[model samples]
Target: MDKQTSRNLWRITAGQRLRYASAIAVTGLASAFMLSVPLVGGYVLDVVDTQDLAQGAALLVEAANTLAVEIGGKPYVAYLVLSAVAGVGLTALGATCQYLQGRWAAIASEALARRLRETMYERMQHLPASFFDEADTGDLVQRCSSDVETVRVFLSSQVVQIGRSILLLSVLTPILFARDARLASLALVLMPFIIAGAYYFFAKVREQFKITDESEGALTARLQENLTGIRVVRAFARQAYEVEHFGSKSLALRDNRERLNRLSGAYWAVSDFLCTAQVCIVLIAGGMFLAAGSLSVGELFAFMMQVTMVIWPVRHLGQVLNESGKAMVSLGRINHVLLAEEESRDPAPATERVRGELVLENVTVEYEPDRPVLKDLSVHIPAGETVGIVGPPGAGKSTLIRLLARLYEPQHGRILIDGLDLLEVDRHWLRRQLGIVMQDPFLYSRTVADNLRVARADVNDTEMMAAAREAAVHDAIVGFPAGYRSRVGERGVTLSGGQRQRLALARALLVEPPILVLDDALSAVDTGTEGQIMAALERRRGRHTTIIIAHRLSSVRGADRILVLEQGRLIQEGTHATLAATSGPYRRLCEIQGALDEAIERDLKETSNAV
Candidate 1:
């Protein structure tokens, strides 16, 4: 692992490291007891020989006497019986300790994963809106959920197993050397090969795991896009095209995963062969030494059993390395998100509550560096003034509203509410005082009442119904079987377009903000409903500042002043009657909409007469 990744891992797992260490210590102690069982069994066998019964009996008595003296002068038979019982007791105790070790290890690992996921989610919430514009939702979900799980498996199982293997190797190596140096030297010959093979595969495996993870993320993105756009796909009859696209991504993921598995399998196969050959060499050498009078039968038996213990862990070490490689890749992916730049929340205090007055002075904005969306725009509205904005398709109508909301900061000039600069105002305080409904409003899959109460959770039912009535959607809502308590489905799919817009408008109105912005919010509703909503707003005149943007000229005909925009510049400004009287963009728009409305009225009358 690189130094940065190591540091990040240590920081994430800092609180749980001590617990993991204690588990490893307990496991090592248990292993020590388990390793001694073979030695005891070998000693018992050496003391019993059938060919020389009298001599064997003498040897047994002598061994019993030595053990009895060691235990403070008990009888020889008593010593033998105690030794037999102690062996079984030690085995059971070791098993119990092993269980405890696993319990502690799991606790530490799960705690680390929980902390990491919470921290990542919190960071994602605070990130700047622009960061999400370029990021794939599916990829982020994979990193937050799947990648964290992979790292958890490594910490909980692979790390613990590796530690145990190292402990056994460290404690058993010396005993093997002391018994027969030549045989131990022969066994050590395979260690260098195993180490070199592991080192060689580590880099390759890490790269492959990274590629596989990326492929999986791409597949997830494809699936997410298809599901989100399912309605459009069905309307256009493109189900076959979507299925083919999804299948291609799935196939790529599968291929990458298979390649990673093959590489890991090859490493394990080589490691296993080396371990098996090492054990065979040790057994054959010990047999030769016994025949040549350089080794005893009992000593050879003990050496064979201990040699297997030392070599098997070395074989499993390759598997641990493979898993660790994947974990390192996943950790890197998670860190990328945690380190993104967050939205700025400067410490600018407000001494007084904001009034409805707003001013934009030479405010300029550009999503790209060289292509400006709004240029040299300036406007002012005193408290409680009703203003309307009309513009062409590429004009700066929406951009102006976004700037006032502080959704995007301008590159030059400033926006002030009352007399304070927006850049120096607390963002949360500023947003809370302004209620906005966008051209494409979004609603949650919740009941009608629940959605309306989102802007002000403490609002009473009477207040909610009043707001719904103002948006001209109250009667329709009550027509449903469950009324305000009915489910709207995902993204308000169960509601009509006009119903969704009015509900969104009602949600904003429930807040009773000091400033309300409706950016073409009523386009989906018919002219009759639009007239009713406007009449309701007229009753609210002088209560708060209202800014309306609309393509339909009639919607804004009663405004105190209307501003017309062309390209990115404000071309004209006047009252609706004055703009309609002149020959400008506003007058031309009014004429065009007037003709369309007449044609619609004539068609309705003709259809009625025919019926």
Candidate 2:
């Protein structure tokens, strides 16, 4: 791994690295005991075959002679029994170590999984909003979930297996050479080929796995978007079309995954044949040495056993390589998110109140290069004033609100509140002081009271009722089946458009921010309820600064001043009546709306007379 990717993996494995190390150590200990079994088996056969012991049997001779007398059997028979007992004991100890290693690995893997999830989520919260502008939520969720799982699987199994493979090769190869160098050399003739095959398999499968993973992410994204807009699809009677679209995504995922499966089948085929062939060559050569009288049958038996032990793990090397390939790809995907730049950290401010005075001086904001959304826009609104903004589509109205919230920064100018530069102060504090309700507000799947109290935890019944009343939603909330405790479905789907908007308004109101922005927020409400909400704000006149953005001329008519914008420039500024009396965009809008309303009223009157 590169230095940065290794660091990311290590950082995520924090709090559990010690446990993983311990597990690996136990695995090494287990390999030692397990490798001794072949020696015990050969010694047992040698004892049963000969009365004279080998040179290494001085210790065996003493124990066998004493046990022979006690058991009343031949010395070789007694030695055979001792060798059997030793082999069984070694196997038992190996099994115990294996159990301990598994237990530790399971615990450590779970911890690593949790740490990874937490790091990804916390990083997302700090990432600047720009990172998600063109990002897919489904792909992000896949990386956080499915990709993390792939890494966890590799850590729990393949990481330890790597150590085991190295230990096996280091220890077993020398022992084989000591017994018979010629046969050992012959046994290893295929090792280079296996290594080369494993490398090729990993290289091919890694790309296939990456393609499959990304295809799955796209399918997930398609599924998520469909579900979120299911009602839109049904209303338009596009079930057949949607199903066909989903099928295409699903088919793409299947094709990518199928390629991975096919590659795996070929890898296993070649690896299985090579491993089996290597073991057969060792056994055949050892039998020839025994026939030449240079090796005994018992010694030959031991050679076969040891050779099999080496071959088994070498075969398993393919699986370990497979998991490593997957793990590297998954870790890279997760690091992509962790490496993004985060917004400025929230800091303690010099004071609590902002005074709600905002100024924009020659501001220029752009989402793309050479294409500014707002150009040379200058405006000033002092504390305790009521203002309305009117604009044609793409005229930078919503961009202005996003700037005030610090969601986006102006490319070439400065914005100030209470004479403090926005970039200099803390962004979190700035957002907290401004309460904004968008045209389509979002609510949690929670109770009515919970939604209203979401901004502040200390809210009580009195404050909830007061805020709801101000937004003209108190009675509606009380009439629900469970009143304040009634659960609103996801995104408040159970509520009507007006109710959702009003509930969102109440939610913002409960925070009691110094500046309130309604970006077409009150559009869904009936005209009467809109008047009630406007009147409520009117009563609090000098207590807060309110900015309203609306298409309806009547909505902005009551404001102290109205500003009209077109194509990223402010074209008119005056009170509603004053703007209406002059010939401009505002007057033209009023005339068009007036004609439409008059025609509707005249049609209604004619129908009534006929009735």
Candidate 3:
């Protein structure tokens, strides 16, 4: 399909068409039974037309006498009694058929909703992070849930109702024309105006419903943002400000709902008026024909029955149009996300082991072209080497770490694992070779073992404990009553900052990657705990390659090589002792931090003396 056509929600859910067609078939069957009622009534009236009142009374007396005989013994009388029983039986059959038709529609609606939600979630997982930056989470949630429900309602009701109405009209119109050509022609004259009015009102409703759905999305997003940030608002003393902001969003949504209500009211009022007027006209015209002795009393009665069938469908057409309008708008919104590009990568399956030699060659990255963050920067770390990167805030430290993981692509230049370029290698394979422990690591609301398994799914409990011991966090983990099975709460809110960071480090260690990157991961721990973790890391020196970015000078002091950055440029690359003794950004930074520490110690001592 062309891109323009691809955006339609109906395309992904084309199965719904078959579902609708099935419902239409059942509705047609039920409507046929109802149409038979009018035909039966007409046939009875025709029988009346053949006889005078005395003859008709004699015919009824004969039917009753036959039924009485059946109760006693006559076979023909039994047949007459059975005919009345069959008519009542057909009426009950028609009611059952109608109920089945509605039940089938409900099943179809529920099935479509389930299929659509699953497809939407799969699409979401594949979409790139850039897509989330542009879309609101709550709005996306609403589309997957509320918007799908709207379409389902239309599928269950409007779709089948329209089919039944058309079938009823088609069957009755011909019968009416056969009975009396003049009255049929008069009734047909009002049809074009009625159809035109329905189409116009439906178009108006469709336009309003689009705005209403959009307002709902915005309202849901606003409410979500407010609730998620409630703690921040309370801390900042912004309760009144937040309340007013939320109220404004709520008011806008309410106004949109009111607009829809007004349009809906106007539409039904006009439709009812037109239908009632048409019924009145048919009654008056038929009465005149009856007075002229041009039409028989029984024939006139049958014509009136046909007219009732015709107008009933016309009255229901408005309801069908209204529901269909709402469904169309909802489908458009839901399809918007389902049709979005699956932005994550998938490649050939990868193995369990990888060597960790990393190389960056003339790398350049930019969120937008002509404003590069890292320009023509290149570095290489052999397997099992420890390299420390020191830089001021916003010196592209995190950007470099992100490139190592392929979170994004560099605008120009290449990154490689061992000798194979990262782009050419399977992303899963490349990621498996490396582990990252970040400054503010994210943890799911799951057991400690559950979170650790994200790194390497096959790791057993014994292996997990060993990895935790290597990260110097085993004592802390076991200190909790539940131990490794303890819940972390959302984002690890239940854990202290130091404990969360230690858990993250242990998770990375569990993977046993050839390369490990610590992006200021030790910033949360105390000096003594930090020392122990570093000592544990030192014991694993030749077993894994490590890249460390540190704010604390002591953290990177043991690195075999140190790279210093200022802005996006690497200005110094040497051993820690060499950089501290020589002149450059690294030496200056060390001297400044050293003086600050001394001053803090002096102030503490003076405060103690005064006390």
> Model 2, 1-611: lDDT tens per residue?
46876787778778888887888789888988987787777766666676456622566667888999998998777777777787899899999999998889888887888888888999998887798987899899999999999998887878778777877888889998998898899889898888888889898888889898899989988888888888899999999999999899999999998998998898889988998899889888887887899997677877888887787788788778876788888988888887888898666478897889989999999898988889999999999788999988899999999999888889988998999988888888898898899889999999998888788889999999999999999999999999999999988989999999999988998888899999999889988899999999899777778899998776788898998989888899999889999998999999999999899989999999999
Q: Write the per-residue lDDT of candidate 1 for residues 368-405, one digit (tens) a residue.
A: 88788888889899999999999988798888887787
| Every model's TM-score | 0.91, 0.96, 0.87
Name the runs in model 2 displaced over 4 angstroms.
51-64, 71-77, 346-348, 602-611
Give the clashing pairs for model 3.
none
Give the better candidate number (1 or 3) by lDDT. Answer: 1
- Show the lowest summed lDDT stretch of 10 residues, model 2: 51-60
Task: Order the candidates by lDDT, highest first.
Answer: 2, 1, 3
Over the stretch 525-548, how does candidate 3's per-residue lDDT look in tens digits? 988899998998999997889999
For model 1, name the residue pairs that clash: none
The TM-score ranking, best first, is: 2, 1, 3
> Compared to the true structure, candidate 3 yields what TM-score?
0.87
lDDT of each: 0.85, 0.87, 0.80
